[model samples]
Target: MKKGIIYAVLAYLTWGFLPLYWRLFTAMPAWEILAQRITWSFVFVAVLVTVSRQWRRLKSVGSNRRSAAAIVLCSIFISLNWFLFIWAVNNNHVIETSLGYYMNPLISVLFAVVFLRERLSPGQWLSLFLAGLGVLIMAVQYGHIPWVAISLAVSFALYGLAKKIAKLDVLLGLAGETIVALPVALGYLFYIQSQGTGTFTSLPPFSIILLLLSGAATAMPLFWFAKSMQLLPLSFVGFFQYIAPTTSLLLAIFLFNEPFSEGNLISFSLIWLALIIYSFVTFKKSKVKVVPISRADAL
Candidate 1:
């Protein structure tokens, strides 16, 4: 448990620092960032799988038609989420982006109830209500729904839901997603190259290395997260997920010097309150037992 918690914290901390790392690439378009993330992540994962002798496991995911399809779908959604998130960070929308992630855990709970028909305790339900209200308040403040936040939260939640059912090992599953998107990423890079606008060729050597290196940055946290999840309870891992956004919020305010408007303050406060209620409620309830099941039922 200690090791798992440590790993989870490290993963979140790495993810939290990601905005600062990607900020260096602000001069490049988000599309280029997305493409590089895909391409480099592919390389990094391929190496890991090879060294760990997980290559045979890759065949298992590929052979499972339903799982393979689900992974491909997850890849698409994750790609979109990564692109939007990187764009938000690079374009000075980090705080808003952080807000979206602040809402993500709540969204995941909603997705569970709606799609998986999972039951939410009354406290959980109330937490969801508070979170929704927070988002609505933010939307009203902005004079429109913050669709970027909605998109990031919903897409990522769905991706998690699909991964739950797919039952592929994390490394293989992520590899599948990258492989599915590889063609598109490569084509985009090539198209940009043909047009003499390629990030790889046009950028300075250091910048190019950074862009490529971002792939390692991209894969490492995920690799750590996958291992941590395997070692920890889903409940604990869920809470740890919030650290990334919280970090982003601090980075936005302190490091990037983004203005936190009155609306942002109120919205952020509500979000923090909602999460506090939800976390406390969840932690308390996890200690209670509503039912007992046989050994086979555990599966």
Candidate 2:
């Protein structure tokens, strides 16, 4: 549990500071950044898998055609999510992007209750209602629904849904997503290069290094996240996931100096209230249950 807690914290911290890293590419096109992230992430994830002897696991999943196809479809969704997020950060929509992540847990809870037929407590229902109200307020603030935020949330939820169904090992599943995205990223990079407007060609050496590091940067936290998931319960991991967005919110507000209007404060407050209720409900439910201790606990 100690190891898991440490890994989880490290993973969220890395994710929270991602804006600092990606901001270096602000002068570049979002698509360009997305392309490099995919290409480099593929290389990094491949190496991690190979070093960890997880490659065999990939082969096993590959042999399962249904799982492979599902993963491929989900990979596309995640790539879209990634592209949107990078675009949001570069386009001064970090707060909106943070809002998307803030909505994620509530979205997941809804999915669990509706699709998985999981039971929900009254607190959970109230939490969802408050979250809906918050979203409504945001829509009013923007004079339209924030599609970028919604897309990020929906695409990621679908991606998580795919991951649950794929049932492949973590590293192998990630390798699949990167592999699916690799060709498109390479094609885009080459096309941009041919146009003589490629960021890669014009970037300084340090920028290039950072861009390359983006791959490992992206992969490393994910590796830690997977490790934590192995050691922790789904509920604990689900809660830990919120740390990333909370950190992102801080970065967006203070570090990035994004505008924080009264409406934003109100909307964010509602979201937090909703999250509190959701956590309380979940915790209450948890207390009513009993779990057997495992061999690891015996140690």
Candidate 3:
């Protein structure tokens, strides 16, 4: 349990601090950065798969057309999520990015009800209502929809749904998706290079190193998160999930100096309230017991 807590904390801390890492590449276009991330992430995971001897499982995924299709869909969602997040960070929309993650769990609940045909408890219904109210309040205040938050939430929710249906092991599933994305990523990088506008051509050695390290940044926390989930209850892991967005929120307010108007506070407060209610109900029903962990737990 202690090890699980430590691992979970480190995983979320890494995710929280990721904005700092991506900010180092502010000079690069989000698309290029995303291409490099997908390409190098595959390279990194390929090595891990070899070392762990998980290639057989990865091969099995390719043999199953349904699984491959699910992974392809997952890749698209994750790539979209990654690009938007990198873009949001570079564009100084960190608060909006954080709001997206804050909305993610609630969005997942809604997805479950709608697509999975799962029945929601009373607490779940109220929680969803509160979250919707929060979004509405933010829209009213900003005079525009909080599209960044909504897009992030919905894309990630869809990614989670794909993973749930695919039912592959976490590492294997990631490898599959990254492999599926690798060709397009390479093609984009090649096209950009041909245009003579790619950052790779002009970047300093240090920046190049950082770009390569994007692979580690993308995969390592996920590895730690998977390890932690293996040791902890799903409910405990769910509780820890809030740490990432909370850290992002703090970073946005203090480190990044993003705008935090009164309306933002009121909106976030409602969402937090909803999360608190949701967590309480989940814990009460699960009785803090460990269950067979699912891919949704990792998300």
Which tens-of-lDDT digit does each residue in 273-296 have in candidate 2? 876777677666766785788999
Best by lDDT: 3
Considering only N, C-alpha and C atoms within 3 Å, which residue pairs clash in candidate 1? Answer: none
Query: What is residue 254's positional error in candidate 3, in angstroms?
Result: 0.9
The window of 10 residues in a row where model 1 has the poorest summed lDDT is 230-239
**lDDT digits (tens) for residues 174-231 of candidate 3:** 7888999999999999998998888886889988988888898998886676666566
RMSD of each: 3.5, 3.0, 5.3
Pick out the ten consecutive residues of candidate 2 with the lowest summed lDDT: 232-241
State the displacement of the C-alpha of residue 264, model 3, in Å, after optimal TM-score superposition: 1.4
What clash pairs does model 3 have? Answer: none
Q: What's the lDDT of the predicted structure labeled candidate 2?
A: 0.78
Q: Please, what is the TM-score per model? A: 0.87, 0.88, 0.85
- lDDT accuracy of residue 75 in candidate 3: 90
Rank by TM-score, descending?
2, 1, 3
